[model samples]
Target: MTNSLPEMAEIWQQTLNWQPSDHQQAQFQRLYHLILEGNRQLNLTRITDPQEFWEKHLWDSLRGIALKGEFITSLKEGASVIDIGTGAGFPGIPVTIIAPNCTITLMDSTRKKITFIETVLTELALTNAKTLVARAEEIGQQSKHRQAYDVALIRAVGTASVCAEYTLPLLKQGGLAIIYRGNWTEDETTGLENAVKQLGGVIEAIEKFTTPLSQSIRHCVYLRKVATTAVQFPRATGVPTQKPL
Candidate 1:
């Protein structure tokens, strides 16, 4: 069952001009099983159909892997990465699947989500991935986690400001925090400037691309951490959402 999924992933990768290595093939197989099991027990995601999984779940997760090649290349093979608010392992699991050399920490506040991720990791034989059942804000402040990651990936999570607060603190200075968002206008970018600045990040770029099958416009906001976040940031969890910086 897992074997067929990688064949599908390879086809998808070929469509994007990417050729998966033998190791990547194995990873995709693991991802397929993980998603399948996760779907059975919890609302990890809504796109359960196999075809929809290929397009919406697999491809959507792989987009970050595709765009951040340069960043991934710079990391030490098996460097640490953290995915905050990793509701269903978007980007993290896919990234772990494609980039076998990198170790990933998939963190979500919900215990069921973490359990689902753990089960997938174990089933897929993904030795480099781990799941944390904790809030992003609390993890970002822990001495062990703070400024510990080489890259931080987030998706469809929150406002740019709030996202930055949650993600940037977990990154070492000069690391990158890639936020996946829907299409945004110039006004939205302008609105986020102060929050980005406040969180010690600079908007490096706002990359726009269309989904392979859907042709839906999507945006990836790349922010680079320039300095340490002030202690006040990530403000008590719910605060960041209710009163964004």
Candidate 2:
């Protein structure tokens, strides 16, 4: 808790064309302290340093939605969003802070992680977010979750094709799936295209950028659902990883 988070208003504006309000910034600081406290018992995240957490977790998470100098308009208009495999609530929590109007569900298979996020929600008084302890494959097949969200976010979950399998099925027609990755390739895009097609989606865009602090390369693959995914999609539990797409 000694290392306080930086305001970095200029950096935020220059990088993402947006900056957190004072209340949101305070919530971000509180979230950081909660994560550090939770890490002692739970191993929540390795990036404990304030600057690193700000750059990698806070800034990096928000950057995924800031395309072409605009935050996705749907987010401001109260869209329903689900963050698949949201371990320790990276993009979802940051997103919930920024997009206060949108309703967010943070899904993770681990109950402990979900429990930690619930604590974060309560401590931050974030009324717009909720936590779900469930597998991606299971939720994608469930009636309540299938084709339910306007935006589906995933990061560091799996391969591109596998990510497509997990997210595409849960999105409504015309919904978007944002898959975050590091070190992308043309071969990977080809593989992803095939997978997304089978799941009733198309590759909308592939954005590449450099991390602000470390200057590391990152990619966000956007898939837009144009048709209903086959009922067989997402496969059985453990199947997406075992035999992706």
Candidate 3:
């Protein structure tokens, strides 16, 4: 059986404990069609089953919405946001669907992914979002993007330490960098503490939850950028991954 927009949305509302407006429902249908169309041209995603889409894609994306009251309040009022390594628009597209006020930059290093994202945005008429094809380090240093967003989000991109270097430089002071990690251990958190502090951020909270279908454990490591990052901190393109703090 195929899961239509209304069916998927009901699952979202039940899983996330929120209602979707009519406009949001329409946006879901748009996304469903766009993703299906894009899948034919390119390997956009492997989870083609509608149930898998609901669990992995929609619910995973809506997990951010669970934090919308606090972690993403700024996005609800027209704040700028960037989704680093937004392959196939995991959290960015769904976040845009729910929070129309946010202006999101969905960025990825691969041209094909950005092409897929741009195509979806155009087909869905999502005017509040844009695409950027660049590495995180390069985008961090660009005059237009540097320190430009209220919040930066990344999912399964890299280690917390390395992801901090890629994401923190793009946020203004007092902004948040939310990193999504799966099954994070205590040792992993301890290992990243120094890197977080070195990057002018403090570990705020590590929220844990279970995915709707798979029941997989997920972790959201929230860090607050308390001060500005040093100009030399990112240390050129690809440095963070090569020599993580």
- What RMSD does each model have against the real structure? 2.6, 0.9, 2.1
lDDT of 1 by residue, 106-192 (tens): 988988888878877877778888888888778777888988987898888988778888888888898888888887888878877
lDDT against the true structure, per candidate, is 0.76, 0.92, 0.81
TM-score of 2: 0.98
Poorest lDDT segment (10 consecutive residues) of candidate 2: 65-74
User: Candidate 1 — worst ten consecutive residues by lDDT sum?
Assistant: 67-76
TM accuracy, model 1 = 0.89
**Pairs in steric clash, model 1:** 78-101
Off-target runs (Cα >4 Å) in candidate 1 are 1-17, 68-71, 75-77
For each candidate, what TM-score against the reference? 0.89, 0.98, 0.92
lDDT over C-alpha atoms for residue 173 of model 2: 97
- Candidates 2 and 3, the one with greater lDDT: 2
**How do the residues 124-203 of candidate 3 rate in per-residue lDDT, one tens digit apiece?**
78899999999998878887988898888898797889988988889998888888878889988888888888888889
Error of 1 at 111 (Å): 0.8
Q: Which scores higher on lDDT, 1 or 2?
A: 2
